[model samples]
Target: MSAVTVGQELASVPYDELIKNILLAMVAAQNEANASFIEGINDLVGTEVKIKYKEDSTEKEISGNALAFGILPTLLQIQSGIIEIKMAITLQQTREFQVGVKARMGFRVFSASVDAKYQNTYSYKVEGSSLVRIQVAPAPPPQPLMRAIEYIASKTAPTIP
Candidate 1:
């Protein structure tokens, strides 16, 4: 059988809260130039575009800090019913895990590492005085393996005894 491993879970924050916070962080990061463009688009689109995370938490705690990373376009252009913002923010964190094993004969201990990344996309329109139709797309999912461990079971079940 293959070995089983799991990562550490956050203490008390809900997933939705995490995503909301991250999205807010992304919006706050936008500079004046891009913010103006976002506002303009909101005016054109009737409905506001917002970002929603499919999972519980889009923000991962790595090391000791809470970080949000993403990409935004340096220049934004609204033309022919299409709006584009071009830039990127790459955020990542590393965590460590400890594993312990006890058996009839002895005990063993080891460590594993896990890393996570979050990428955000900023594009929006200005409707009236409010920024509407804000769309934020998360980057691809984080990889599962931050570290790898391998071990042989004692005698491999003895070949069916």
Candidate 2:
């Protein structure tokens, strides 16, 4: 409703020019917000902090995206010998961030991956003993008392005819 009102108010401007103006305004607003947010991040750069965001970069004509992470060292005891990672955020500062954006954007759209599988899966209770069969089952682990008793009997028992 408010958007509609604002659009109606801007009707005096030409349609194409109005759209361009709106986009320009949006970009300006985004940059200002980002600068302020980065400044905040810079404040706690030397401290232990974990921040998660999406990184996008373009090199030549190719572009890629990934989950960007920033972690600060937690061990203050070893600060003398250890190198700590810090973040710097400056409001309205002139900086060309070619590395990528560090903003937290919600609900990024991604294409479904084609049958990517996870690694390190183990199944203990297999049914088929053959070469080409896969089985999955859940079995309880052996009890410690029974194992101890078996061990003692084996060690102490004498041979019988």
Tens-digit lDDT string for candidate 1 (54-127): 44655332221011111222344222232232212112221234333222233222211111211111121222
lDDT of 1: 0.29
TM-scores of all models? 0.19, 0.23
**After superposing candidate 2, which stretches have Cα over 4 Å from the reference?**
1-11, 46-161
Q: Model 2, 64-135: lDDT tens per residue? A: 111112221221111112122121111222134424433233211111111112111222122311121112
Error of 2 at 114 (Å): 48
Distance from true position, residue 140, model 1, in Å?
Answer: 23
Clashing pairs in model 2?
38-89, 39-89, 42-89, 45-87
Name the lDDT value of residue 62 in candidate 1: 21
